[model samples]
Structure formats: C-alpha cells, structure tokens
Target chain A: MKFSTEDLIEGIRSGNKRLIAKAITLVESKKAEHRQQAEELLKEIMPFTGKSIRVGVTGVPGAGKSTFIENFGRLAIANGKKVAVLAIDPSSAINKGSILGDKTRMEELAREENAFIRPSPSSGFLGGVANTTFETMMICEAAGYDYILIETVGVGQSEVLVADITDIFLFLKIIGGGDELQGIKRGIMEMVDIIFINKVEESNLQKAKTTKLELKRALDFIPAKEKGWKVPVLLGSALYNEGLSDVYSTIDEFISLKKKTGSFEGVRVQQAEKRFEYWVQEYILSMMKKNNSVEEAYIQHKKNASAMVFNPSTEAKLFVEKFLSKGPD
Target chain B: MKFSTEDLIEGIRSGNKRLIAKAITLVESKKAEHRQQAEELLKEIMPFTGKSIRVGVTGVPGAGKSTFIENFGRLAIANGKKVAVLAIDPSSAINKGSILGDKTRMEELAREENAFIRPSPSSGFLGGVANTTFETMMICEAAGYDYILIETVGVGQSEVLVADITDIFLFLKIIGGGDELQGIKRGIMEMVDIIFINKVEESNLQKAKTTKLELKRALDFIPAKEKGWKVPVLLGSALYNEGLSDVYSTIDEFISLKKKTGSFEGVRVQQAEKRFEYWVQEYILSMMKKNNSVEEAYIQHKKNASAMVFNPSTEAKLFVEKFLSKGPD
Candidate 1:
C-alpha cells in the first residue's frame, strides 16, 4: 500500500485507523527512504495537529497504569471525545526491546471503536521515552484524536521528560507502602500536576485515605515549583472503577481553570520553547560528531597528557580556535 | 596578573590558591576569550586528573548537606587526604542567582588547610550543578585533591545527573517525621549508593535506627538498578558528627572492593566515555546553531503550519536532512 501525506492527513481527519497506524509506523521507522516519506506525510498533517489534550501517565512497574488508563479512556469516550493511547514499554538495556505489550494490557480499550492504541518501544534512549514519541503524539493529534494519552514505563528520570512533552502530568502510586516519600526525589513531585493514589479498593481503602492525608501533609513542607497551581492528591481504584468520575471531573475543572487563567496556553508555549532548545542542542552535537574536530582534539589531548608534555588546557583552546576558524561546512 | 595556561598549570600543581581560583573562573566564564583560555587550561590539566574519588551528596533543604560535608571533609583530611568541596547553591527563579553561600555554611572546612571550598551557582541549569562543574572537578583533582565532593541542591531527578557524574551517590534525609520515607521519590533512591538518615542525634537516634531498618526492607523490594551493589541505609547525625567515621569507612570499603575486583577502573572508563559523549554532543549542537539550520527550519515549519501547507513531521525530516547534509562547520 502506497501512503502519501494527503492520504494520511485525510484518513486521520476522517478517523481512519489503518492510515493512522501507517503514519505512526512511518514516523517510527529508521530506514532512510521511509524517513523522508514520513517527513512529507507530517507536512500534510501539520495543520490538523495541536487540537488535542496530551496527558502523560507514569509510575512504577506495578502502579496499575493500564487499568487507570482504561478507566480514563472510557471516561473520555463517554464524554464524546475520541481517545488515543500511546503506551511506551520499558526498553531492554542490552538490545533496546520493549518488554510490556500494551495490546494485551489494554485489550478492551484496543477494541473500542473510538480509540487507537500504540505500544511503542522506548528505544532505551535518554529521558525515558523514545526520541520519536514526541513526533508520534503530534501524529495522533493530527489524526483527529482530541485526547492523547501517553503512558510511559515508570522508570528513572525519563518520566520528567515525558512530563515536559505533555499537557498534564499524572503520577500513579499505590497506597500503604513503606516507600520513602522523602526519598521520592524532589524533582519529579514538583513536576507533577496530580498524584493519583491507585488501587483504592477493598482492603486498601483505609490505607489509601491514610496515605492521601500523609501526602497532603508532606506536600506542605515542599515549596510549590509551579506558579499558581498546587499539586493535588486524589484517590481512585482502577479495578472496581471507583472514583473515576471524580477523576474526570477534576481533570475537566483543572483544564477549564487553567484555560481561564491563560495557564493552558502558557504551559504549551513553555513546552514548545523547551522543544526548540532541545532540538538546537541535539543539532549542534550532531554537527561536532560529523566534523571530527572532537576526535582530533581528543586524540591530541590524550597524547599530550600521557606524555606529560604540554598541558591539556592549552591544547584544548588551540583545537577550539582551529575548528572555529575553519568556518561553517 | 596575566594568566596563561602554563602559569596556571604550574601554579595549580604547586597548590597556589590564586592560580586554582583563576583556573576555575576561566572555566566558569561564558565570554569567548575566557572560554578559549579555559579550554586550553583543561587540556593541560586533563593528564593530572582522574586520581580523585568523586562523591555526590544531595538532599532537600534543611537536610544538613553543608554540615555533613564539613564533618566528612574534616574526616577525610584527618585520614591524610586532601578534599575539595564543590557546593552548588540553589538558584533563585527570579534573579537566577544562587542563595546558599558555602563559605558561610562550611566556615570550619573553609579554614582547613587541606580542604578546598568552591560554591557554584546552579544558574537555573537542570543538573543543579554548574555547567563547568565537571571541568572544575578536573582542575581540583589536578591540584592534588584526592577526594572531590560535589554537593547538589537536592532537587530530585536533576540530582540523579549529579550522581551520574560521580563515583558514589549519597542521599540524605531526616528521621521519624510523619511518614518521611513515603515522601521520597523512588527514582532517586534507585540511583543512590548510600541512604543516610541524617539528624540522628540524642532525640532521633532510635527513630533513625528504625528508619534505617525500614529502609533496608524497602530497598529489598525496590530492586537495585546497578548490578552487584545493594543501596546501604545508614544512621548519621551531621549536627553531632556521629556516624561520620562509619560513613567514610563504608565509602572506603566500597572503593577498595571495586578496586580489587577491577570495577573501579571499569567505572571510571565508563564515566570518561560518557563525558566524551557529552562533549561531542555539545560541539555538534553548537555547530548546528551556527549554521542557522534549526532557526530556518523552525521558522519555515511554523510559517507553513500556519498557512495549512506543511506537516511537522515532514518539516522535521527535511530540516534534519538539510542540516546533516550541510556537514560540520
């Protein structure tokens, strides 16, 4: 099947699954020919993008992400919104393969008429999510999905990067654990918009309530990193489908409040600015690699150091000057 | 007092404070001329580096990092080793200046003959450490400091980056403060080598012990990210200087074990490899910016999107290709 930019754009605008999947595959592919084609496809679909709300979900391995996402998706669908789920599986350190299969976990959601499910491999790159995940989110948005949910493999500092690329950051945690909240790393909590205590069912109800109070108290000591908004802690159970209505309502209220205060646009603008800076940083690094100036300087400096000859500082400056004087390629 | 690379190198080797400060100032300078000089100075000192043990300490404000480091440094010096404290102060969001003055906080250490103290401004950088901190470490190492302690503003995930650049990561926390452990981010704990329950003096000693045992149990389930090492939880009091000796002994044991097993060299090699990669990345990114490829592509892409003409993916690909083909500057 031949895929073009217009076809993908039209299919997405019309909510065609096959085209959307094909477009994402093209964007995710590493092959040179497919990459160029993907580029062309994105150009055609660019106008239809940025119309959706992008929510990023992250937590530890047993944090009930799939169940919560399913509940959230159902709520959105019930509200007449088309939803797309992009589950980023944790990558293998050795070969960079994704472990969890989102299709299996989100079976019901995958089967929904108004939903699209994408199980993406993290690619084991820095910042947790795949480098292409950001592009994939845009593709989903362009395809007429009004709600894009990005589910990350809850591992390390990558979730923070995931937060940077999303509209709302949702952190999931289980109740009544001996986990060191003080050790939770101040950075992640500061970035969170909402902390949802999951699995508040049956025996865990009291524990969840207790944990919620504890968290509220703890948050008081930590100064709010974000302006205007306070991080809210809520409880929900993905298993029994309890508190999901409240969750949805809270999200709606938060969105409306942010939009009214112009913070919605402000957040998006900040994200875009960061995206721009990251791209520039990535580009410059690529240039240095291609030029071999780094290699030349490294080799010479290593030799000088090993021999205890001229100091490394002098050698580094000389290399930088020589490289700069060579001008643009 | 004109400073040249040779003079700086010689003075640093001879333990001249002025030369050492001048070298760090050069590295920290953003001006083009001073930057060139700094780079040159680094090349000279690169050979004399890598002998020091780099330790990264991080905890929230009121976690007693300065007090802890002072005691730790004094212990290191008492053991006949020179210590250099590179303290990174928390940056003010409004003025972008660091507030915590290390000289005032670590007055005792500052007065020690065998200790070198330098407080670096975070400058709103993500890592919570200064941009030239790694370079500064090298200069300090060359100046005969065998133990280099990097103290970061315990801001969560960014603190992990500080750990990434160090040999050992020590995370500090207070004891028995209403679910203190539950408040810590799991991500930070995963990267920690040692978890010190600080302020464990007369009043909190029992609580600290309980916290340590609880933490040990918690660590069991969390799964260590690094192979062959369990994150050890210890009780300490920076105020009373209790447990300082044990902390130093634990670090020494770890380093010795690593050395005997050949992991010490292996770790350093890996760290050096990462540093090299970062250097290359920065170089290429700068080159891309110089050629205006990013700015042009971004502007063109934005313009096309507004006109309903171009897709973001396609624009990104074209932009990347054009920039890549343009080659290095």
Candidate 2:
C-alpha cells in the first residue's frame, strides 16, 4: 500500500502478488487521498488492463457455486493459465454478517501458484461493491491474471450488476425437480448465457437430464441473451469433477460467436457509456448526503411533499441548483 | 383546454366531463408552457386526489383481462359505485403498433353514465407513461371517481411501476393448468394482493379449482404482503358476470382492513417519498440528454473510455462540472 504509483504499476506488470493485492486495496479505499492515488495508479496501468476474459458465476446459496468455481479455477491453472477470482460479497450489505471469502472453500485453488483469489472488497463508499469489484478486476488483469472469474451472490441485484461487467454470465443450478419453476423467477432465466446443472454425479444423473429438458422448455418462453447463441444446459459435478471441459468450450463458443456477430465489443461499448451516467449519479447522491444545506432542504422538502404542497421534480431541481451554488470546486 | 385556472378548478370540482378531459390533456402535454400550467392545475387538485381506491390489473396478452374488467366494472356500477379505467398502452412506447384502449372491450362500462374510461395518454416528455397515468388518476379522483382500475401490460417493467402507485395489485389468471407454474415465474406471484382465476364458467370449473389449490400451496412459500392478510385465490366467470360481488366484497374488506391497520396511509406516504428520488434521477438524465455540449463530451468520453484513456466516474464528474458551469439560470 505504500509503494509509489510507478513501482506499483511495475510490480503488477511483473506479476508480483503482494503488490497486486496492495494495488487492489488502494483502489478499494474510501479516503479521498487514496482515491486520487488509485486514479493515478489506474492511469499508469490502463494499457495493461482489458486483456483478461471476465466471466460471472452466480447461483443460489447452496447451488455448489463455490465448489464449481474452485474446480474450474484449478482446471484452468492446470492448463498453464493464470486465473483470478473476485467475489462481490452481499452478506455485509444485506445481513451485516461476516465476510464470505471462499479462501477455505477453494483450498486447492488458493494454494495454486498460477492462481489468485481475492475476497470481496469490504463495504466502502456507500457500499458500492460493484464499483470496487470492477476496480479490483482491473488490478488483477494488470497483474497478468488472464481468466477473471467474478462470483456474485445470486440473490438481489448483484447478479444483474455482475453481468454488465463480465463477458459471459454462467448460472449454476442444482439438479432439482423444480428447476423450471424456479429458473424464471426474478427474470434470471432471461439474463443468463449458459446454464450449468451442477451436482449431477452418481444417482442424480437422470434427474439432471430431466431438469435440462425442463429448463430448455422453460427457456423457450424467455428470449435468448444473444442473437446466435442458444443457452446450452450442461451437466456437471464439481465434487467429482465431471463435465467442466464442455463448460469452457461453451464459453469459447459464446466468445467467438459474439465476436463474429460484433456484439462482444458492442456490449462492452455500452457498458463504457453507462459508466459515465453511473459516476455522475453516484457523485451527486453522495455529495447531497454530505452537504448540510442540501440535507436541511431535503427535510423541509419531505414535509412539503407529505402535505402535498410540492412535487418531486421541482424540489429535486432546486436541491441540485442549491448544491451547484455551493460551488463543487 | 382554453379554460382559465379558476374555471378549470370549478369544473373539475363539479365533475364536468369535458373539463376533466381537458385538464388531463394539459398534464399529458410536454411543452414548457403546458407543463407550467399542468403543475398549477395539479396543485389545485392535490387536496381532492388520493380519494380513489387504485387497483392494478395485469396478465399475459390472451388472459381475458379486458373481458374481466368489463364485467367487473359493470358489476361495480350496478352496486352504485363510480368507476374509472386507465389503460397504460405499452405499444406506444415499446412496440409502436395498435392502441390498447378498453373502449371497445368494455362496452357496457363505456356506456354507463357513472363510468369514465380514458385511453392511454400519448407519448410526452421522456415517453413517461407512468407519470401521465398518475396525473390522469389525480384528475379522475378530482372528478369523484372512487374506484380506479389501472390496466398494464404484464410482460415487462410496467407492472412493477404500476404496483408502486396502486393500492392493491390484482393478477388475473385464466384457468390454465399451468397457472401455478407461470405465476411464480418472474416473481410476479409474490407481489400480487389477490389472484383471480377467470373464465371458470362450466367445463373449466374443475380445472380452476385444482389450479387454485396448487396456487395456494405454491404461495405458501411466498411471504405475505401485509401482517394480517393472506392473498386469496378466487374463481370467477367474467363473461357470465357471475361471482363478481365477492370480488368487490374482497376489495372492500381489503380496504377496510388496510385502513384499520394504518397500512393504507402508510403505503401512500412511502410512494410520495419515492416520487422525489425518481423525479431527480429522470430530470438529471433528461437534462444531460438535451445539452449539446454534454452530448459532444459524451461522444469524446466514449472514445477515451474504449481506449482506456479515461474511466466513467471521473469523466462523468468532469461532464457534470462542465454542465454546471453553463449556469442553470
């Protein structure tokens, strides 16, 4: 964390794990000085970023997500590829529980010299986990981690947010009879590019196949995520390490298909454009929360709102106008 | 449309149909002069608004929603109650094809002197259908329409928006064997206050009963919307005009229960508060879109973003600062 910006950039480029972690910590910092430093650090290594394949893995709590990611990460390392895993921890925000770092769960991958696993950045700056995770990913990419796996808690808005930054979104579903019934809930089926039916080893093989068929039928009602690619449902056993090659192959197929259709770059371009909007909105909201004058105005505004003497648009405009008069500079 | 503000206010208080329609047209207009007038008009009607019991009705395209509303509205009118219908035409903003007015479908209600049915408002600023619908509802309430039925296309984001503004959300389910299966899909089942199994006239009676049982079991997993109320599934035949009094009784009971429990006023106050945030976000986005300098900056920013020369948050802040410098005055 104490390294100069130039040295940090050099360390990351040289694949120094300690420096990579420090750089990620710097980006995750909420302090203004750290942010300024992080910006400088990001600027120095900007060219080295965007070389990795970002994949988002999501499922409900007990859906074998950790086990699957562990095996998948180890498999990639065995193939002589450098891998990095970043998780967007939802517990701290939703339940105020302890951090759910997969360090213990992914024991083998944690020990793999060719792999790196980072816990979800602690809640910082309005608890903006997505932004922190994204910044951490850039640091990982600069550190020469080629395959970046982003794991999000499948509940709430985390999965949708993860899908925006990642290239392919893979949904891991446990082999259950109610697969079709639960898949379409929360509109999750419409967002996924691939479905992995995990825990399909031993006696569960037939049930998994039936679930695949049911899922395919259920998906018929929902539109495809991409134009040319049909979301293939593949069976897997993360515990027994079965049917993962097909998973990577499907991802490769998706990447090439998206590239061929030019949607790969197209989606990324849109994300870049969305980033501009997000920054302005987040900055405006945070500043309002911090400003005493705006806070006072909002209290008065709420009273007027309850009395039906004022409307939201006019009051919001006034709030912004007053904030502007404070002179942001 | 040409009436003075005092005249318009008096006309609406007297339930003058022509003046009420003109006031709604004013609210639906996007021009600056009209918007200024609309705000003033809304202020005058604010005391009279929030008098209606708002209900949102949604289903898939072929779900007999129009037919059900027709018979149900007639039933309400027969019971000496005033009814108003507002259909949110999704085609205008999304599909751009035919208008989905309930005029033809609800012939009986359309002919009733005690009933007032308005088609969806034409596109206005930012193509905000929900805003127009809310404004229109206020105008209708000023004219003393006590029972307000809002019809939304159930497929997309519209239903969720409708749910926020209404008192009770009613989901109409045709007596399909897969009622329970499809209802839980997309988390829509969890949001409804009541589910109506429509078209259970003769041959579909048995199937409807079975569907109701299955739905009740499936709903057991979903938490209740209110502390003391459970979502009841009922069978009805809209075409035959049978079992509709029970529907109104259930609604009346729900209103009395919610009023007694203080949640009726509670939800409305929360909605008023949310309106403030929504207005701020929408106004900010719209103003940025209209500013030519900001537009040019965005184009340049996108280029820099793709080249990794800049990130979204920093560029967005710079863009906002530039916009602020133009002087909002």
Candidate 3:
C-alpha cells in the first residue's frame, strides 16, 4: 500500500492505472505524512494536469447517469481519447455505497483499458470530497487521460462545486411525471453548458421532443454561460446507443468554440482561483477546529444564543476577538 | 448627533423614530469605536428584539415589490400593527439609488404614522449590508414595531441572506415575457414560504392566473420549508389594492400554524445560529485582509497558478501553511 514519492510521480506520468489509483487514495488519506507526500506528488505531476478535456456530469438518480457516462466514455475511446470518470457524492459517507461506490455501477466503462473509473471519496464533508476529487483529477490527467468526466448526483452543493472545477458542465434529464426540470435547480441550469435528455425511446420520443422544446424556451430566458455559444439540449438514449455521437460531437464543438473565443483558458485560471479560495476557507476552519478555547467559546455562544442571552452576531464577534487575540499555532 | 447609550436605549424602547435612526446609523458605521458602541447597543436592546413578525420580500426589477410592501404594511397597520419597512439593495453601492433609495417609492407607506421606511444602506459588500440590516431589524423590534418587512431586490446572494435573518420569506413575481418564473432562481423558490404574483390587472388577470397555477405546480415538486406547511402561490395586484388582505391573512395563518407546531421559535433560533456563522466567516476574512504576508503570498500564488506552475490546491496549501506559521495579530 505504501509507495515512494518518486514511484508515484513516475507511475502517474507513465500512465500506470494502479499507481494512479494509489496516488488518489494517498491524497484522500487524512494522515499528515500522507498529505505531505500527496502535495509533493501533485507538484511533480503539475505539467500533465491541464491537458485533459474536463467535463462535469450531474443528474438526479434514475436519470441514466451511469449508462450515459459508459456510452459516452466508449464513444470517446472509439475516437482515440483516453477517458477517466470520477464521481463526487457528498452523501456517499452517510448513505454508505448508495452511488458509484460499487464498481459494477459503471461495469462496461470500468472494464475498458483506456477508461478509469473512481467512486466518490465518502469524506462526509463536501469540501473534503471536493479536495480529493480535484487531486484525483490531476492524477488522472497525469496518467494520460485526454477526457475527464466528473460525475455528481443532483443534490445539495456538490454539483455546483463540480461545475467550478470542470471545463464544461453537462446535465442529464429524464422525462417523467410530465414535470420537466423538476429536480433541476435554477443555478444548475445557468451553469449547464450542455443538456441531454436520456432514455428517449420510441415510446417517449414525443414527450422527449416536447420537453426539449420547453427546456429550450426556459433556457432562452437564462443567459448563456459564454458569449456566442448556445446551450444545446440534445435527446439520446444511452441504453439504445442512440444519439451518443451527437452528444460527443456537441461536446467537441463546445470546447472548440470556447478555445476559439479565448474564454476557455481564462475560465481555467478563474477555476484555480476559486479552488484557492475554497482552500483558504478550509484552512481557516481547520485552524478553528484545532483551538480548544475557540471550541469552548463556540459551544457557550451557541447555548447562550439559543436562550437569547445576546445576539448571535455579538457572540460571533466576541468569539472572533478571542480567537484572533489567542494567535495562531 | 451624539447621545449617551442610555439615551439611545430609552429612545429605541420608547419608539422615538429619530433615536432609532441614529442607533442604526451608529451600527452601520465602520469605525472601531462605533462598532464597540453598536455592540453595547445591540446587547442592551436584545430583550426587545425577536418580538416582531419578521418577513423578507424579494422580487426581480419591475416586480412591483415596493408597491406590494407598501400595501402590505398599510394592511398590517390597519390591523393595529406597527410596521417597519427596510430595504437591503446589495447593488445600491454601485447602482446608487436604484431601488428603495428615494422615499417617494413608498410615499404612501412612508407617510403612515405607524409605518417607518428606511432605504437600503449603500454598503458595497453583501455581508456589510446584511449585518447592518440585522441590526436595524433588531432596533425596529425594540422600537415596538409589530411587523418588519425586509426588502431586497432579487439579485446575487442578498436574498438568501435575507431569508436567513427573517422568519418568513415572501417572493414577489411579475408575469412578464410569457415566462412565469423567468428571473426567479430555483434556490430562491425553495426558500420561499409564500409567493405573490403581482401586477394582476384586468388585462393581465388571465395571464396572472395561469402563471399562478403553473407556479403552484412548480412548487409541488420543491419541498416545503416547514414539515406541514405548503408554500402557497397567491395572485394579487399590489397597484390595484386587491388581495392585500388575503396576503396578510395568509401570512398570519402561516405564523400561527408554525407557532402552534412550535417550529416558529425553533426557526428563529436557527436563524440566529446562521447569522453567527456568517459573522465568524466575516471576521476571519477581515483578519486575512489585515495580514500583509497572507496578501503577498496570495498574489504570488495567483501568478504561479495562472502560469500553470503548480495545481491551485497545492498553492493554496502552501499559502495556508505560511499564513498559520506567521501567527495572528
């Protein structure tokens, strides 16, 4: 289970899947020594990280996410692109194997030599899961994956974070109960660069067409993510191997357009800035957690706040004052 | 202009409008001494706070939000309730005097003996505006206002923060461009306790009715804020002086139902807890801003990140390590 730093760096750069997985697991480790090693490994692999086409996939459960990714990954491989699929389920910790935890979830994709599939980290905290996912993504990129599909279920804040780290965001929708965009949050809609209406079988083709029109109309009101680029809502069935090529071509078109406009590179830098901001918050929170007096003050303040002894803002101000006066470790 | 703490407290408690305004201005001041005075004033007025029906109102531009608030406040006064209307336009700092800045926007309500209207504080940051709004709300409560309406233009993060500080969140939507929920964000829809489709004139009555039904169906998919509460979408014309009483009665019913279920008090405490969390972040951010080494490191890391020298997470980790080792002020 233990590997030298140079081994991880070499294995990652040489596209060794086993060592890549190990590096990801190592970064996910909470051990202080492992964290130091992980940081060093990441720095060594920095040159290889930004070459992949990063795509984010999100949809409600039963929306055929696994199937779509499998078909899409296969299509990319057919087009001579190495694919890596990573899932980020913030609920994975509590739900305990509800989502991509099982390799069988993406069985076909998992069996592909050119494809890499990893489950959610089960970190319990969104930030922890996100950090590991980012690390895992960089490791995959170093391992020569030309395409990365970062998948997250449609729930809570995970999708938003996934969108932040990806070059393009894809949303999958299933027509059910006649309520189009029911589970989709408006913010997610705004973030989406492409949408796929999955499972458009012969029986539901009409319904799919209707939903697509409605979705397009709804999208017209929402601003496009980039100038001169329209978010296309494509209909396809991953199960039937239908419209997969269209989906693949659309993604390629989006990337080409973004690159042509020069917004593509700008976005990546901004994403890095956002990631840095998240780390700043994470570090501050970690420091607060380590301080005993801060912990005591937080507890006392919460109790007094419940009893309305003082305003919560006042208690917070007092807590911060005490914390700053104590100095950092 | 300069009064003792006792004078301010007595003025707030005795419902002296001038003194209440002065106390709020003091809290809005960024001066260190003024902050200390504001803390003292807030703590002294703690007992008198949390007695009013705290309501938050939000709508897109031209959603007739001011007209609705004016009518709603008048209705509350007709029911023998003292009303306070405060606007929280986060954009006010940049778009000087765009919304609720001029007293004439709610001229009728402003002239009411029992109604007090305050324009949005043109503090640039959303947090600064929200903090000042919270303080002003508490001051209004101490001034014996039985009903407080916090108005924020539906933009950015202001609506979410406003929802956190208030007991009930009401969303005002205007039927426009044939898009029922064109500008309304989904997260806002979820947080909304009640929705009013404003501008239902005779010509647009049918359109409003259709929009209301469509909105009701949309709300069905989103879970209610409270366990037993169904978020109602009501149709009303704020300009025509119609359905204002219905809106008032619905709000009263909601409060009573929540009170009977005992969730009302619990929500207020949770809101206080949320406000405390915000203050914690604000203080940490302020501390980071005050630290010079942290600033220098951030700039350097940003440059390196843009040049693709290292992963952003790695840079952020280095920055955090440096910041903590520097020790706090």
Best by lDDT: 3
Arrange candidates by lDDT, descending: 3, 2, 1
Instruction: Give DockQ for candidates 1 onward, in order.
Output: 0.16, 0.27, 0.42
Which structure is stronger by DockQ: 1 or 3? 3
Among all candidates shown, the one with the greatest DockQ: 3
Best by TM-score: 3
lDDT of 3: 0.81
Q: Give, for candidate 3 chain A, the lowest lDDT window spanning 10 residues.
A: A122-131
| DockQ of candidate 2 against the true complex | 0.27
* RMSD, one per candidate, in order: 6.5, 4.7, 3.3
lDDT of 3 by residue, A1-329 (tens): 37999998888888888888899989887665787788888899898779999999988888898899998999899889999999877666676676677656778888889999887785543223444787789899999999999888766788887977899999998999857755566467778899999999889899999999888866765555788888999998998889889989898899999999998999988888877767666656556667777768777886776677997767877888887777545
Candidate 1 chain A, poorest ten consecutive residues by summed lDDT: A121-130
Going through the candidates in order, the fraction of native interface contacts each one reproduces equals: 0.16, 0.35, 0.51
Per-residue lDDT for B266-327 in model 3, tens only? 98888777777777766665566567777687789867766668877678778878766775
